[model samples]
Target: MERLSLTLALGDYEHTRDLATGQVPVQGVSLNVLTLAPEEAFFRFTFFREWEVSEMSMGKYVSLRSQEDKGITAIPVFPSRVFRQSMIYVREGGKIDRPEQLKGKRIGIPEWAQTAVIYSRGYLTHQAKVPLGSVEWVQAGVNQAGRVEKVKPKLPEGVRLRPEPQHSLNDMLLAGDIDAVLSARPPRGFGSGIRRLFPDYEAVEAAYFRETGIFPIMHVIVIKTDVLERHPWLAMSFYKAFEEAKRRSVERLSDITASHAPLAWLAPYTERMKNLFGEDFWPYGLEKNRTTLQAFVDFAFEQGVCHRRLELEELFPKQVLTSFKV
Candidate 1:
């Protein structure tokens, strides 16, 4: 067997860095996965970029932006473990214990983030029965609060929107500026802040689709469509490897948890991911996720975030997904 050169987009978290950089040899497979945020993925995808990368990112937005482009393939894997806990953050100094108490309070979230803005908000409105418009939204960023691509049509009314570009939600929360901050995972070092807010704060189990009846999109692994055409077997091999990685990650979580002690919050998150990505959450390629994500595209289109709807074949490489499904 020949070793194929592959590039994966690794995130900035310490554990991911450890997986990407510190350990070169893992169970006989070596990946030169580069780390970058969603904003940087597009620039990194350029073929001539200095970074040696075969695959880059195609975030959920790609379903809208890359509708016609055909050179690359993207697979939406489980989001970086950090994202799993984003937006589900601690509410400090408030009488808000249950989801209902969140009403009329100020909520701080990252700017222009589609995941938390649309999906998380929708979860609160639809399942929790909270009146969406009643809460005030502060978009925290630098110089500018990120833009909301499109508001889902079904979001509850009376939601007041506030734009805060001067500081981050973490800073705002600690300073007593905001009632709650929405984060993917807990901010890097705010366990004390979380402790301050809710001494016994346990995570709230929430899923956008299950709660709101809409497919929520997040991160996934993408391979170039042409790559699959040339090497069909590689697709299955890659899928199987990640599945095993998930399994290895679960069975030996102590090793993973111990090795990546930097991510204290990740301890609980790993179990939820194991449940979702376990059998119910199959990396059976993209089909299962697609069925769910496409509905999101439809919702986005209906909400007017996207001008047009995307067909699965148009957005994804036709060859790979079809084979994976069959």
Candidate 2:
């Protein structure tokens, strides 16, 4: 039988490189992979369904799923996971010296429903004791103007978010129009009178992970529901391929003979991560990531990114939920 032909659009990630380069095959599928930037792939795929399979923001996916949009379904293959403590930026010599000071301050975000902002806001509310309504939120692009939220979020009661399409968050934060900014990418003026809210963010993020067993997930692999309906086996094939690719990347990270990563002391860092998280630190699959996934659903709902709370099962298709054991 001829293999099913499919197209996938996603960011050029180190872990997914093998799959993208065709070193790893998706079981019986002939994948035409388009390695685009995450933003481009997300925008095109979310709005236009540009590809049969793509990487989608968890926040946006949860929002869409909550609204009962059945156009797309996901596998448990997460392409991106990041801790957002380091994503927050504050002005130097500003009143907001600490996370607690974020209360009653103005914060800029690229979008209200942005995955990074959702996780950052969740951290503020749960860890920093700052309520979502405590501060005003300004929305705009990170470095350019006229960016808007792709999804319409039902703002929770007492939440106040204003869109400023005329100016970028980078400019606003530099001009002090916004007290701080929560962004995945650092603003252009990051070092020019701007600094991370947590100067020692690595330690803070590690501690946060320890305190709450939630290593925040940013993006999930999704396929058009119609495509899945026609080819139900595609989900497991994609999941298994992604898992093998990630496993190879992890093995390369642990190699001490020669550095797979450019960073010095990568082996030690990988070991540290292994100690903090288990051997499969960057894990794929439902059970290993349930804590983070469940927390994200709760956060997205509470923050109004999702109109209503969503069960974990609702996010992924049943085919990829479990694999047959040998």
Candidate 3:
């Protein structure tokens, strides 16, 4: 039987390297993988549909789905999961020393629907007791001018959102035009005097994980609806392949013969993560990630990034929802 050939746009990460290099094969399918940075991958795919399968932001996916855009659908394979406590950037000597000070302050963001920004806002509003309405919001690119939100937002009343296409968040924060910036990517010229709002975010993130059990999902694998229409099994095939690749990466990393990662204590850190998250630190699918998925859904809606709240199960194709146990 001839295999289905699909183009997949993804970031070049250690976890995805196996699949990208064809070291691990997808059953009955051929993946023409394009390794790209997260931002470039998203922009290229969003604007050009350059690939049939791509890594997409959970926030943008949810917001787009809420608007009934049928361009793409997702599998539960998340290529990137990160905590956003470290995403908030502030000037070296800024008044926004803590999350509480962000209230009633002007802050810049690349987009309203950025997954990292959504979680940063959620943690600030819900966990840190800062009201969304209290802060004035500015939207723009992190390092360049003229970036805009791909999805339209329906912001709640009293939540001010101003677009500053004339300047990037980096410039705005540096010029004192904005108090702080929320971004997934570090802004250009971000060093020396500029640093994270919480330089001690490592400890903060650890505490947050213990309290909330949310590791914060950043990106998911999306298949163009047209591709899936002809082959529904593509979803499961892709999911299983990704799962196997991830499992193998973790296994290799844990092996002591040669260091899979450059870290001096990679094995010990990997073991620590397992203890922290229970078995697999990075898990795919619905049941294992229900809490993180539900919280993200809630955050998207509350932040007005999504027009309506989404149910977790409805987010992915039904084929990847269940697994056959041997």
The lDDT leader among the candidates is 2
Better of 1 and 3 by lDDT: 3
Per-residue lDDT of candidate 2, residues 39-148 (tens digit): 88888888899779999998889899989998999899888999999999989878777898999999999999999999999999998999999999999999999998
Ranking by TM-score: 2, 3, 1
Q: Would you list the C-alpha lDDT of every candidate in the order shown?
A: 0.50, 0.91, 0.89
lDDT of 3 by residue, 1-326 (tens): 99888888899888878888888888888879888889898888877898899999888899989988878999999999999999889898766778888888898999999999999999999888989899999999999999998889999988999999999999888888888899988988578667998888888999999999898999999999988988998999889889888998899878877877777988888888888888888999999899999999998999999898788877888889999999
What are the RMSDs of all candidates, in order?
6.7, 0.9, 1.1
lDDT assessment of candidate 3: 0.89
> 1-326, model 1: which lDDT tens digit per residue?
55666566645543233345533233324467666775456445543343322333233344335344555555444444222323556544446666666777777766333544445554555556656567777766422344332222222235455666556677677666777766554554366554333333223333443443333455555566576567555555554455555544444444543645556656566667546555443343566666556655554443334445666555544444654343
Runs of candidate 1 with Cα error greater than 4 angstroms are: 1-6, 12-32, 35-63, 66-72, 76-86, 114-117, 142-162, 193-203, 206-217, 223-282, 290-314, 324-326
Q: Give the poorly placed runs of model 3, Cα more than 4 Å off.
A: none
Q: What is the number of residue pairs that collide in model 1? A: 13
Model 2 spans with C-alpha error above 4 angstroms:
none
